[model samples]
Target: MELLKKNIHMNRQKSQAVMQVTLEEDFNVPDSKADVGSIIQDEAGVKIEDMKVANGQVMVTGAMEVEVLYVADNKERKVHRLTERLPFEEQINMEGAETGDNVQLKWDIEDLSVSLINSRKLSTRALLTFSAAVEEIYDVSAAVEIHGDGEISSLSKNLDMLQLTVQKKDILRIKDEITLASNKPNIQEVLWKSIQLRGTDIRILDGQLDVKGEFFIFVLYAGDDENGTMQWVETALPFAGTVDCSGCSPSMVDDVELSVASVSLEPRPDYDGEERILALEIVLDLDIKLYEEDKVEILEDVYSPAKELKPVTMQQVYESLVMKNFAKCRSSERVRMENNQPRMLQICHSRGDVKIDDTQVVENGLKVEGAVFADILYITSDDTLPFALMHGVVPFSHVIEVPGIDGTCRYSLKTQLEQLSTTMIDSEELEVKVGINLNALVVRVHKEDCIVDMEEAQLDMKKLAELPGIVGYIVQPGDSLWSIAKQYYTTPDRICRLNNLESEDVQAGNKLIIMKTVEITD
Candidate 1:
């Protein structure tokens, strides 16, 4: 007997590791910039430069970009900006990782603080966390059929499975231009800017993918007027594009994650030769995985009545998608200013980020506990310090509905800040509204014992001769026609024909006759 096998392709995560690092550094003010008096606000971002994988370990090299806005100590008390890059390297221990493995790295800035050490020096510190995962793609060989000259009795089953069809990484670059309004002044120099993406949507189509989103851009710049006063502009820009995804169909399920890898804004001159046009270049990185459902016919068990047959079996693991859902959490809170801090004159801009603290599987759902860290930039009542920053945290606990979820299910969650807005309730208190979006994909893992190959040997003629040619038997519990025939060295068809049975079904305590068949080989 020969075993016919088929290979099923699959993609899974091999191993994952997370590392946290605290970075602290001291930087001196540039000779051209004014001396810093006090810091107002700070922004930070992490960029991965290179990743190297070795035996059982991975090394990640990256840099943190920090921008600080502070008031100068001069008589004018002007707001000045300072920027720096801090390089970092971390080695993570990951078992079963090897060279040329596909590794994905995700980073977050937990906290960033900047303090004024002296009139010319500043101290900066940041807490960062990095998560690394290695993905492996392989094939599982399973027995589907058998081909041989002997009469083989086989049992087959149909299994529902998910097959990985596409696994790749691609980039989409969005280019657009923003022109200053006719009423706004010409740009002299950009001081502080914040860019964030919100309400992003990704759709899978035939041979392509569609992406649509809007990014909020806020820029505080020094105007080219006679007084050189500082001016700010905030606007939301809409972006839409498509990616060419070969072999992708609408029926397939997609698990795609997108992030803004890098962005830049350049000041350009308009038709009148004034710096009115701002050129924007944003790069989006996408990690794509597509799965299609399939039904496979597999050999479950095999036996032979005329010859000795033994099947070799092994265990294989498979994955099935349970659910893919998107959930949203809305929260509103009031932030009160401290007695020592300056009161808010008017709200300018607001930004927030969502951090997941814990996630656990509950009854038919996933419980998510997290907080939103928000920063509000506003004009201050104090004439000496015209601008101020307020920081607040809004804690949230929500349960995402996922039917049939259990401890054995594997899930991945991605969170994003869909909307953030701030309004002044009073001079000392402000109201904050936040909208968070959570995307989750849950899968079930199962193991199955499958027959791979079989070994054959010659039957013993002496033992066969000692056995009786006919016998009477009574059906016992957990008895089947195939099992009874195999136990007596006879075919199920022969037993059914002798008993005049309509089907292979048998009951306990039923009387049956068994006969042995001998095969002669030359």
Candidate 2:
């Protein structure tokens, strides 16, 4: 709810008034983390004596039985092809590893492979493990080695679970203190917030405990036991009929207030894989603290798990976004100085460096170096930057697609930039932004959701010459051809194509044309 008050007080020549405002804030923390990696060891011809899953996470639990399906020890620089099948290896070693430990077992496939890759570094033994719950059930079996990693080389795969942890203790204490303070003995497990109680008759009444009033915003506290309803309060839904209550109310008292501060995510490393994090994650570390009178208390303990809200993919954020293709997404903590006046001042734009390497090159044949580009995030507001600030990143890379192939070679790509523009709001002007990204060959088909301006959509022998598609429309009351043209980025003559109108004068019911936007990717 928004509250506004207006008044005028006369001084000698001017009048002024000051108002105070209060707001509520809450903290959010990540509750889970899944990391995948590996652990390697030394051994050979080691068969799977056994395997099992011994952990519980979401849906993991029970005995896990895994078998050694394919294993091989090939040591050759040249590629080998085989169609004929061979018997599997039997009677393998399954000692040393515990019931919960992930183990790798290996065996030689072709005797000739040993000699061919004699000089190569191959893991004589390797282990493969998928995510399994603590109490999961599984079947285990022994089999011969299928593929070889050149020679006796070390290779393994493992998934590690990580629990989120806080980066700042102070922030954690503040958030916890605030949230806990707001939570009060309303009824059972459900707590009522004191700030929501609204009463104009309540200035600081006699005691600072509970405000006296014909309650305005107060919710009636009520609930049904296994039998029937008692005093029902609307704010106690989550704990209604759930928590065992004291069955008695405490003596009426006052002098307490509650509020929320901040929140964060924490992660605890459960496996070696957790050491090296991957692409996606929704975790945080928070610091919270509470204050009363002049005393302060730190509160960082989490009472419950926080569900994932918005899951972001690195691929979409990286490749799909125009920024990461040619240019990498960059971020940094920025500090600035503001004057006493409550207003924003213009500041310099942000600039950073983007390094490109070998992700685009197929092999050692083509190598390109990444270049530095100009970038600036001019946030000219107070405290927080406005979300509407213009932001565009230009990707740069040295084209390596051979010189002779005209357009055939991956030379340079057309620059694409998106922003909430501040200039040219209602003017006919073209602005150009430059950047580079990998562009595929051009393909033109019927535009899917294509934007264009045309005369009409219906097949009319009378005005077939004017209709370019559904890109045109007839002018209506309170409509200008310029706005119609801007909507399609075309001219009145172009609009004349579909509607079949002879002049600029648009009729209220006359049909006008509109163009659809074309789909392009880089």
Candidate 3:
């Protein structure tokens, strides 16, 4: 007789690779632009054009857009904007990769530097990091129940499997006509504009996802004033979007990411010159990942009462995205000088970069250590009105107390600068503070054992007649009713009824009477 067995199927697939590269480029100023004097603001955006896999390697082709706002060296102190697009192609080693695999890539600028080469040329350098994750879907038909004349013993555990329900990409466009305040100047030349996604609120209902978020728009514009002075203004834009995810349930987990692909800005046509109005257009890329959890009982081991059975067992480990945590870390650093310290006049621009140094998984959560680098440009306390640059580094450490995390889990951490500011503490000192956000996604791999197949073994039929129908047995350590009944060729229900036991749990050193039944095969 064949033993009846059950099996469980895993629900998730995940793999990741990370690599870093330094990018450098030399760009000439536009034909009509003046030479660069001091760089004010620098921004970069990355777009993946194509990706493919062959011979255990992943080929990635993408472009990085770099925009710099700088002051000209002319007598007028003109402000100019220069933009360039640089393409890159690289191969990353990914074991077991093949064609048509689903791959997602994320690009990050870790550090950047802009140097003035001449009045009409500039050099740009940046340290970039690319991370890619590939997930493959598998459909496994698990056996739920066994059908045969044999006894089946199994071990099982509950798993919150991550089942991919929906994967889709869409474009979200934001159009708005914003009017400047009465005290501000009219838009002459738009120097630079940056968009930051501050927060997101999501709701899932009836296979649909509703998304709402806040976008902060910072614009630096040169006024129509006689001196052509430049100033910066900020505004908030509220946006809403929807995603269709059919066959998805409300109990499932959702992971959504939004990125700015491109942006366009123009002065409104009906500008009255009193309250300056500008038209803003922004394109956003959206991605949705949904996961559904399932529980299944797997048959681990089996045996037969009338024969000796050899069961084939197999074990495998699977990985899944467990949870993502969003947190903010704030730190401040002070730069001091004893003498000849440049006094602060006004800060032109300020930005920061944060790097994750280490992550230690403890009993409850993770202890994260990192450092923040701040760059500030200011019209300093010096002659000839030269722009002075100051840099500061601050070290930070934070404890993320998330419960239920163990040694078997791994995590990925990403940090971004939210805001940076500087305050002059005295004529010889300045305080720099930065606010950064950390997004940590945890992934877990679990192991399970399953009984694949079984074989029948020979048994002694003459010994069955000499065995007693009822016997007294003493419970030993780690003894259970199922184990005792399976050994005596009886069921747990019959053993409980015969002994008049209140429950299936029995203590050690207890005496119980067992009734046995022997099965005969044809």
Candidate 4:
């Protein structure tokens, strides 16, 4: 055991540490010299050397600067609508993400936009800029819902490390469904009242301000067509779009304003066999922004350091892939049981991490006294079978841009996956929720509906045999059915029926037990 030394806190502060980097001067430009077939020299009709030369080096170096951003997340530590917020979140969901899925993150602009090149000097660039008004947002809105049961893991309970991950590829379908759940009901009356008062045309959009514990929302409003008098309602419906101003002219209308409400995401499981996916939905409240005024959307643009701005890294590429997957994701995944046959299973998971004050021998186990952030990323898949379909290489890497530590400003990347938690959280909440029921899938495999059978069935028997409300038996080193019957609660006949015991002698290693949860009353 590596004895505990002075512990170092990983995520102890939120200070934006700045470092001065000297730019290097020299650079080697790629030689563009190409082979050129030579024509006979005008006089000397001899085979001559090919001559095709390219441009020489042109130094375009300068002090390109950047900042770093790093935040942590655990899928299991789900914050509700009113929960406290983090500055930033480095969440990379492989399957996809839903609207209102709070993306908490800390902006590490320094690292992300600087120090990518090997040297400090600047180089030439075929710079390209995009300065065109987006033609249109043909389709501006969509909703996603992931369904799966979240099993408690031991580490999560004791260590409080929670995580969950959903893969983008597992998203079955990305459908476009528009639902007008409820209206203010008094909107029409308010608009008519404004028209009666002789108001002009109406307009709407969201208004954002840096308010603690506050976010933006949208509302409805109306104005008179003749007099240009503007009026709005006190009540608003949460929607997910900006009020169209193209329809209203600026020559007549002054604009409008209304209250805004914040929105968030919530996930829950629906276990109806009729519905293959876990049960939950994403609700987008669009009518939260005050749109009537001339509002400017802030696109944070910071000049990056020469090193931070470079081609995409594997991590970034993976993140983009997951984002694409989640964007096109449907509610759930369908696992193939019998070749073409599919079955549903639970696929919910959550993950979290912490920066302990002191270094320890093993991960997860807390020392006598430790200071930790316990930041978590709570994630849930759309369904049992869909989550099971998620498969890919999950690994970790490091770069100076997203460095593990920065003076007082340190950054750490984390993945909070509850469904595929190969690395136990080492906490109680995690250990209790680490198991899932693949019995349907198992049955399908046995019935020849599934192509492959379960191999290397590795699980803690203590946690495996007795699933929540289910029941089973433990294999003693040298015990038989008759001895077990005399030792405990049930009788020999009951044990025989419970475990499918054939003969008087029972195997010690294999636990023979009946599961109550898997049993059907009907």
Candidate 5:
């Protein structure tokens, strides 16, 4: 007897770890730059350089780029930007991790603090969190059919499973330019800029993946006029393209994630040789995972009337997608400035960052709790410091309805800032409106016992001869026709034909007649 088997491809997370570290550095202002008077705005970004795995640990090396916008301490009191790079190295302990294993790392800036140490010196500190996961792909072989003419009686089961089709990492480079409007002034020097991805959508197609999104860019620069006035321009750029992905089709399910890896913005002259075009080169990293649903019939149990068959079975675990949902949460709050802070004359620009603090699984839903950190840049009342920055935190709690959600279900949630705006209510109070989008995917894991192989041997003549040839039986709970036929060393068709039964449906306490038949060999 031979067993026909099928292979199922899958991936599992081998090890995962999360760590937080604080990076601090002190810098002295260069001689070319003026002394630091007061800090107006600060931003920090984390870039990973290299990661090495050995001896069940991952050594990560990276640098944090910090930019500080402050007022000069000289007579001009103008806004000057100071940039620095702080390097960091850390080791994360992950058990069972080996070399050549695929590792994924994600990082976030928890908090950033900048303080004026002296007239010419500054101190900066940033708290960052790094999450690492190692994934391993493998295949499982299951027996689907038995090929032999040995009077074999087998039981089969139909299963709905998900098969992994494509797993890869790719980069999408987007090159575009944003031109200054006719009413806006030409750029002299760009002091600060912010770039963010909004409303991004990714879909799977035949042999490719479609990506569409809009990115918002805000630039604060000094104009080229005689007085060198400071001007700001903001615009949204729409992007649409296709990525070549082999073995991808519309029938497959995709769980692809896209993130801004790095961004480069440079000022270029337009056709008239004026600095009116902002050249943008953005690199987006994508993590792709595609799955195809399959319906399979596999042999669960097997027996032979002419021989002894012992089947080997093992428990296998697989994941099936349950639901995918996209939800939105809207919130508004009023922020009051402190008594010692400067009074706001007019609001210039506003931006926000979302951080998810905790997520809990409730009855048929998920509860998410987080805060939106808003940074507002506005014009001050004083002439010496015309621009000032204010920070506020708006807490939000929302429940996303996910039917059939449970604690055992595995889920992933990604949050982004959809829209943020601020309205000045008074000189000291500002109303902030926030719109957030949440994307969630939930999957359930199943464990099933499957037969992999079987061993066959000759049956004893004495034991075979002692069995009864005919009998009357009463069906009990949890009893099927296949089980009764297997117990009596007969076939289900023979029993049904002798008892004049229409179908194989058997109920408890039902009467049935069974007969045994032996194959005659010449």
Candidate 6:
């Protein structure tokens, strides 16, 4: 018996393995240094320099930079700064990983320890953690076809699918000089400086991407005075440019990550004294990935009328990567800066950095918990030490509003401090107001049903012979017109016409008349 057939073929990319691995490392200090001191404040910065893949493994190389400010042994304790750089190497075992695959790495400082070895030496231990993921992308194909002799019926559905197109890396640099205000003091030494991104907007053009944003540059400098007083200044540098991305369009979605690679500072040429002009050099790295949004038609279920048919089916529940924009949130905190150094002081300069420690998805939003590390330089109430600095940590929690979020969703969130300012409420309490923005890409998992295969079903001749020519039968559970027609060697349309029925929906315990017209052929 010849059968009708329909065939379809398409190419798809599937991720074979998505794995995460963590690594740790440690280092020590040398002699001739101050021993056993109380750590006033410390901060650690981690970055992944490069990644390479070899036989069955991925090699990651990176560095961790740590800065510590502490009080050493003296008649009166004073804050002293110490800095160190630790290099690390780790290998994540991926059984089928090879060159030309995609690997992502992020590192963090898990633990840090400091202890005294002797009067002149100290021992330091640090635990560093690195997480890496190796994704194997391969081609996948599926074809749906109908194979039968009689009329066939089927169902279809539409689905939104995400396809990754390009992944690349590039460098962007900013080299220019900025002049300090006339009222501010000259820069003798920089205590703390932070470069933050703000009000970033991106657009797509012909063969390129347009990026426009402003850099919030904040600097706390020690003035060249008799007591080396501290003061702070801030400026916003607006920048606009384009990056070449061949065959890019506005319809596609892109993810761009910007990071500071290196930074340098120098005194402006031919300028001296309080009329301060400083030169700055900053190098930033950009990682961009493009994705195409597509809608696909899928075949769900099928049936045949004249011929006995058996259709094969398969079900798959998959995650679609979706980019979502969350509403900006503002939080306020009050820090009490009183620690026996001075009391009831006047604030000179204040700056802080916000770090997100944890994130949890909630109903139509995200909950984040982190701390703000701030250093405030102030004028003491007494006349002994006019300029002094105090360090404090203020913890905060905020909920970012985003729609269509649930517990099963996986996401990667990027957070930034939009605005930070401080006001003196009292001699002991400082009122700090902070604004934040949380951008998220939520990967939602959706389930769909599909029909994969179909074949002609064979019937028994002995069962057909035992059936009466005209009979009355009662429909039972799980009964269909297609099945009953195939049993009596008739078509569903002919049965419906003979039984005076409008449709093929048969209910259980319903009485029906059956006529079997089978010419017995030997």
lDDT of each: 0.87, 0.23, 0.71, 0.21, 0.86, 0.64
Query: For all candidates, what are the clash counts?
Result: 0, 100, 1, 120, 0, 0
**Residue lDDT tens for model 5, 316-426:** 877777777889999999999989889999998888999898999999888999989999999999888878999888888888889998976877788988888899999
Candidate 6 — which pairs collide?
none
Cα lDDT of model 3 by residue, 277-314, tens digit: 87888787776666666655555445455466666656
TM per candidate: 0.91, 0.13, 0.85, 0.14, 0.93, 0.73
Question: Which regions of candidate 5 deviate over 4 angstroms?
Answer: 457-469, 516-522
Ten consecutive residues with minimal summed lDDT in candidate 1? Answer: 513-522
| lDDT computed for candidate 6 | 0.64
Residue 306's lDDT within candidate 3 is 48
Q: Tell me how many residue pairs clash in candidate 5.
A: 0
Write model 1 residue lDDT over 1-522, tens digit each, in one string.
Answer: 678999876567789998889999999999999999888899998888888999989988889999999898988898888999999998989888899887777888876888888999988898998888876777878899988886777888876677778777889999999999999899988899888889989888999999999999998888899867878889999999999999999888887888888888888999989999888999999888778877888898887766677888888777778888899999988899888899888988889889999999999999999998998999998988989999888888889999999987888898989989888889999888899999998887777887888978767677777777898999999998888887777888889999999999999998998888774333
- Model 6 residue runs over 4 Å out of place are 1-42, 54-57, 68-82, 92-98, 110-127, 134-137, 144-150, 184-192, 221-232, 270-275, 306-317, 321-323, 344-358, 369-404, 447-522
What is the overall TM-score of model 5 with all chains considered together? 0.93
Q: Which ten residues in a row have the lowest lDDT in candidate 4?
A: 439-448
- CA RMSD per model (angstroms): 3.0, 38.6, 3.8, 33.1, 2.6, 5.8
Candidate 2 TM-score over all chains jointly: 0.13
The residue pairs that clash in candidate 3, if any, are: 35-119
Candidate 2 vs 4: which has more TM-score: 4
**Candidate 3 local Cα displacement, residue 331, angstroms:** 3.0
Error of 1 at 156 (Å): 2.4
Q: Where is the poorest 10-residue window by lDDT in model 5?
A: 513-522
Q: Which candidate is the best by TM-score?
A: 5
Q: What ranges in model 2 sit over 4 Å off?
A: 1-140, 144-345, 348-361, 364-388, 396-522
